[model samples]
Each structure stands twice: as C-alpha cells, then as structure tokens.
Target: MELPTALYLPGDDGGFTATPLTIGPWDVTLQHAGPPAALLLREAERVSGIEGGQTVRLAYDICGPVPVGPVRVRGSVVRPGRRVELVETVLEVGERPLMRLSAWRMRTRADDPAAAVARDAEPHPAPLEPAGSRPEVPAFFTTDVAYHRALEWRFAEGSFNAPGPATAWTRTRSELVAGEPMTPLQHLLVMTDAASGISAALDWNTATFANVDLGVALHRPPRGEWLGMAARTVLGGTGAAQCFAVLFDEAGPIGRSSQSLFVEPRAQA
Candidate 1:
C-alpha cells in the first residue's frame, strides 16, 4: 500500500480522503487529533458562510481511535447569527464515527484605539528567535511517529522529550492539503494537539496519556506562521490529567488551549 503524501485529498463525493498524516501517538495505523481537528475547522469555515469572521473557539471530542486511510468529513452550520455562527464537522471512517468538531466564528469589529477601552490581553514572554533551532528532547520517542515529522519545531524552554513545562515554537513546512492554503487558525490548531507532549508531567516510558478532547479559545486570529506554545501537563493520582497552554505568534498572545487526558501506566512488555 502507498503511504499518504498529504493530510487529505478531495474526494468525488464532496468529502476529503484521509491519509497517514492522520496517524497518532497511540497507534501508527490510526490517526492523530490534530490533522482531523484542523480539517474539520476548514470545513466548518466553508460552511459558516460568514464573509469575514474569526474563529473564536474550536473544540473536538475523540469518539475513539481514528483509523488510518480514507475517512469522510462532513460539515454543516448548526446555528446562524449576524455576529456569530456555530458550525460542526464530523469525521467518519466507513460506517464508524471517529470524532466531532464544533467551532464558534465571530465577526471582527474595526480596530479603533479610541473605542478599544481597556481590552483584556494576556501577558507573554519575549518572543523566541524564529531562525534558531534547539536540541530535540530525547525522551520524546513519541516524536518518532510518522505524523510528527510533518512539521518543524523549536523549543525555547522545555523539550517534548523532557519533563516539566515547556515553551515551543512550531510551524508546518508542507501544505496540510495539496492545493488549498492553510489559514492562520488552521496553523494554530495544528500545534494545539501537541500540548501534552510539549510538557510531560510523567515519564513517557512508564505512563501513557491520551487526550480525549481538545479545546482552543482565541482572543484574536494569529498573524504569522510561527506559533509558540507555553505548556504544562498536570497528572493526578486518580489517573486523570490535563494539559494547558498559552498560544502566541510573533505578534503576541492570541489565545489558549486545553486538553483532557486519559492517564494510565503503560502495560509492561
């Protein structure tokens, strides 16, 4: 069988076909949450019909492990508003449902310094050097997965292979889709799924964590290609955990992202 060249390719029936880029950490034969999530938002934006609105929130629920290969993506507008719109996208492989994504798109108001009275803004550290590369953390064997190779990453603080909180700058070199240009929101969404790996509270060799859901809220749309995430993972004694991150671009803080994880010890070999 041929390996996937891109994340997806258009299908004859209006749905797009899935590729190996969908592969996730849990299984090589399965798909990652990042690609599908971004793809869902892409479809949702198309269906929203809002001329010029920013996606304020993007959330996803992982129904189960998404298998690799051809999957169908369907999107529709669930709520309509002049200022805001709600859209949903579902990914299914054959007859099995994999995941569902919901997004909130809001219209942008003209920027007027006089009218912008005390706008809430998040504080961010000085932006990392975009042109420099840091050493890769060896502990992140998860990075060995096929999907992880699709993007370029530079860590300024914590390494995905190392424990504790981390600050990472990431970007994609290849198109998520063959011909379609990826949006700023899509670029930001791609890195949101990396939150858990960026800052591991537990050892990857002994513990396994899978995020069951992902939620992202953006104060504003990202401007440049470089997306920086300052992330931390928290694991509880009760086998529950959360990963949180503050997102930024070269300009400044754009928003935040979170993940609810299913934490457990990996079965001994």
Candidate 2:
C-alpha cells in the first residue's frame, strides 16, 4: 500500500502543487484540512525565519472546499519579530482561495529548575499494542491511500467507526511533501485536524461533522516520531460542535488542539 500523507507536488515555477493524497472528510475529490494545514505550517515556519523557536499557536480557516490537484501556495510574514512572529499561507486553485492559515512562532526559553520541580504530572499512558491490521471502514470514508496505511495508529481507547471519544497513538510513516522533510510541528499538525475522525461523537452513516476551522497550541516543542491523541467531540443543539485533542509524544504532554465543527446531516453529492 502507498502512503497517503505526501500530497505536495513539486511545481516547475518553484512552488508546490496539491495532489490527491490530500483528500479529506467530505469526499475523495477534496483535500483534507490536515495535509493543507501541515503544508501551510511548513511554509509559515520557513518564511518566519525564527530558528530555534517553536510554533505556539496555529489557526486555519477553511474558506471553501479545497479542491484536489495543482493548487498554488504562497507564504508571507505578517508580523515579524524576534520573540514572536506571525506568518500566513494561502492555498488557491486558480484565482479562488480555498484555505488561509496563520501561525505564531515564539522563541524558546531556558526552563526554570524550580518550576520544573514544583508541579506534579501523570505518567504517560502505557504503550499501545501492535495494531495487526487496519480495521474495516465504510467505503465512502476510505480513500485511495488510506489513513491507516500512512500513519501507524495504535488505538488504546476508541475506534474509527465507533461513535465516542478516543485515545490513540499515531506515528507518521509517510512524508508530508514528496521530497521535502517534515518537521516535528508539521508531523503533529498533520493529525490535528483529524480530531473529528479520531473521536467521532456522531454516526458516520447518518451525520456529518465538518470542521471549518482548526486552532492548535503547543506548550513545548514535541520530540520523537510517535504522537498520542486523546480526542473527544462535544455537540450542541445549535448545529455546532467542537473536537478537542490533547496531544502527546513519548516524553510527556506537548500541547492541545481545537476544531470548530459544523455538524449536520451528510449531504448527497
């Protein structure tokens, strides 16, 4: 099986193009919020020019359905500074803008020894067991390069098809761009937008939960390739919901992510 994560095509004009591997929730023809979000983050980090700093927060707005194939990407520094830098990246198909993303990069600081000793913390969850085979999922939800094939998912608390909160360990076995190196932040961000799928509170056969926006905040730079997510979806009566994922790596708690979801019945294509 081929990897599903690498979706950026090298462009002749020194830019990158979108590929079908970016496909997401709505359908196969559209790209997922995670891949584009990761792509934007990659560019943001590049343009920010703040080396040794970490991404403190990332906010992405899905302006419309991000179509598959050959979308253009542009990254720029909106507010530049030494301690804090704001960067933005936009993905467009022709003249139509599909998604816009902004990120805040902050400088790293030496930790206070006293602060480290003052707080008590829980131990990391037990390592997940080997996931022998990919679980069976509905055909409508499956893509040409399935998520299971791209990422090594060792589920500890919940399942993809089940309707409830979930906790799982995810490690990237695939690349974000074909030949480009994916940073730790990019790796984490690639799965941030999948909180809805990791923990679906709604039925897949009858309902839809489309996240229009994603907000991610990291307390410290993540280490190791494996990332863990404890995600849940909370729905309200006003046709809105939220998917929150507490992120982790082998070391300890790293950060958290939030997605503003537009919950509704699945619309026929």
Candidate 3:
C-alpha cells in the first residue's frame, strides 16, 4: 500500500508510522520509525507490569534500506527487570534480514543518591528561542526532521557547507502524552540522535561517513529546557570515521554519544 505523504512527516504521532524504504547495497532507511520504538519498548515494560519510569535505550542497525521491500518487525526480551529491560528487534525482508534494532529500558534513578549538600548548578542552554522551521533537505540528510511534528529543531551551527561537527538545540513541541509530565532523560532522547557525525563540503554538496555504527549513552538525565548537543567528528579514515559528542541539558553535562562513520555524497553517479 502506498503510504500518505503526510504520514511521513515528523512528530510524535507522525513518528509512529514509518514506511521502510530501500536503497543501495544492504541499506534501508527507516522513515517515521524512531519514536514508535519508544512506545513499543514502553509497552513491553507495561506488559511485564514493571513499575517506575523505565529508562528506554535504543540502538538500531540498518543492514539495507528496509523501505522498498516487504518487511516484518519482531521483538523479544534478552533480559527483563523491574528497573531495566533489554529487547531486540529485526526488520526482515521475507526471511532475509534487512535491519536489526536493540534496546535497553530502565527506570530512572537519582543521579546522586549519596549526596546531601548537592552542588547542583544549572547548565540550561538558554530558553528555547524558537529558531523556527524544519529542514527540507534530501532523505540522505540524517538530521532532517521534516517528517517529525512533535519535535522541532533550530541549528546553533548549520551543517550546510560547514566542516567539522554540528551543534543544535532541540525540544518537544507537544505536552505530556498522559499529562503526567516527561522526565529530563525522555527529553534527552528526543534530541540526541538528530545530528549525524559528518559535515558537508561545498565541492560536492555532500557529506558522507562510511561504515556508520552509532549510539548515544546518557549518564545524567536532562532537567528540562532546550537540550544542547555539541557534536563533532573525532576521527576519520579511508571510507570510515568515528565521532564523539557531549550532551548538555543546560544544568550540566547530561551524557555523551559516539558513532562510527562512513562519509559519502548525495549525488553519487
């Protein structure tokens, strides 16, 4: 069935409906497909009947563009707990595996339980100033949020024709799903994955990072406000690269993210 163009738009609701797309050698783009995994992991937590706010961590691998072929999603538990749960999913193309995603869901815990006189100093990234408008770049642009509605982005440093890493401040546009309020860690996940590891060069109008395998790990949960991502490529090599990033929620450092990269161009012949 042909998916609606609007359905592909980004947002919390929009993210729930992803249409898999196929391209290149062993590559598939998962469209409007991220946040639903959030809901899915949460559901698994509920079905297990666990208590407390479980921290859900997700990591995905794109074997190929799962978009163009017949795909199926199946998930299972690796380790289950009231505080943490591990699960994995595979997007298979008629028995041939196309992509796999793994996740860890855990309930939130205080960053410091032993401290009494906390040296709590806030590192807020300025109030969200509404930088405005989602991007309309090609699908190859990994950070494009044109498909998302619930989350809007404003780039502190635009990736267009820029070298080095990119920085952006992002926040949620919608209120709490159940009106119970979302935690800082939940906010961190919303913006953590927007920026990829490579930068575009003017010569080819393309930024390619080959052999890209990446993940974001948050040590301290964000405490509301605009979460800032100071992202940059740490190293690169022949057909490959790696990046390191520090995440800030304005109160202090929330956590960090690192990814393996494979740089390439958009208009490849």
The best candidate by TM-score is 1
- Model 2 stretches with alpha carbons more than 4 Å out: 3-5, 111-120, 125-140
Cα lDDT of model 2 by residue, 123-164, tens digit: 554245335323343344556564444566677777877889
Expressed as tens digits, the lDDT of each residue in 49-167 for candidate 3 is 34665443556565643353233456677777777777776655567665565667667666564431242554433333335423323334333233334444555564523566666
User: Model 2 — TM-score against the truth?
Assistant: 0.89
TM-score of each: 0.90, 0.89, 0.62
> What shift in Å separates residue 179 of candidate 1 from its native position after superposition?
1.1
Model 1 per-residue lDDT tens digits across residues 1-269: 23445677887777676666666776677777888888888878878868788899988999988776677888888998988989998988887778899999988888766533433353454245667647353444443545665567888887777689988887775567768777778877777898888788988778889899999998778887778888988877798999999988876777889999998988877
lDDT value, candidate 1, whole model: 0.78
Q: Which stretches of candidate 1 lie over 4 Å from their true place?
A: 1-5, 114-122, 132-145
Error of 1 at 183 (Å): 1.6
Q: Order of all candidates by TM-score, from best down to worst?
A: 1, 2, 3
Clash tally, candidates in order: 3, 0, 34
Candidate 1 vs. true structure, TM-score: 0.90
